[model samples]
Target: MKLNLNKKYANHTFHIDSYDSTSIQLHNLASLTLLLELTPRAEQLRRIIIDKVPPTFRATLPKLIGTKGKPILRRLNIVQQRAVLKAIAANEFFLIKGMPGTGIVL
Candidate 1:
């Protein structure tokens, strides 16, 4: 794959001409390969991290997540209720995982 740099390197302090051709080309190729390999994982992890954070951190998120609304006590089982409350109050990331039938709401 041909990796074309979008920015003008001449504008930056470091000029492309300073590096030897072979090393610069190899570095670009390695960078392109590393970026392609990690891009999806990085994006996925970003969404996961953002989602796990408290809704209060983002103004729009609370509305989307329905934090302002009254809790539907009947809809949630004991475990589900606890999980939901904990998720709302949690300062850090948390993942709720379970097998089928065991409600894991996060």
Candidate 2:
């Protein structure tokens, strides 16, 4: 199977080829493998698991935070923002979960 992906955060685009398999599970695995290979976060996860080191966490959300010079019209809610800051300071991994349309992005 061939998959084309555009990086949402960067100006890059590429195609990945995953060989067809008889089972859907195999195809899903192939796609997941491709994703792991493409994302740097996967490497962080690996280091966390193998080397027992804290993962370096970074997040970029245009709607939540402004760019280098420009200012944002709105900012993330104070509570959520504080939580994220605390997690990063503590080197903790946090999972933000919310229902659809809650404007939560993670």
Candidate 3:
């Protein structure tokens, strides 16, 4: 029997050709495939993330706020300001999560 899938599933048409009932399938099977593909790359990134930042660099990051000026910082609340600072200071990656109207971008 043919099934009508959503347009979002269009990009994953290859899965239909490769379907196998013996294997376990999750609700978003492509996510599992993506995770598998990303596992090795994540391991590589983990090594870089684990590397220590030099003491001098870490010390200078706080001073940057003063030298760069505070016009932007003055507009944000305490939490948003801290998030922006952390994002700036991050060596590899920084993530901020907030409600839709919380303005994580600024």
- What lDDT does each candidate get? 0.58, 0.53, 0.59
- Model 3: worst 10 consecutive residues (lDDT sum): 51-60
Q: Can you write out model 3's per-residue Cα lDDT over 44-98, one digit (the tens) per residue?
A: 4545444543222143476768667488888878878877776677665665567
| lDDT comparing candidate 3 with the true structure | 0.59
Model 2 per-residue lDDT tens digits across residues 42-74: 676666665777544556444333343233223
Give the CA lDDT, 0 to 100, for residue 29 in model 1.
81
Q: How well is each residue in 1-106 modelled by candidate 1, as lDDT tens digits?
A: 9665556554557455465688888897875565456577645445555455333322233553455434674576778766766666554455578863385755
Better of 1 and 3 by TM-score: 3
Clashing pairs in 1: none
Provide the RMSD of all predictions against the true structure, rounded to 1 decimal: 15.9, 15.7, 12.3
- Model 1, runs deviating above 4 Å: 1-71, 99-106
Q: What order do candidates take by lDDT, descending?
A: 3, 1, 2
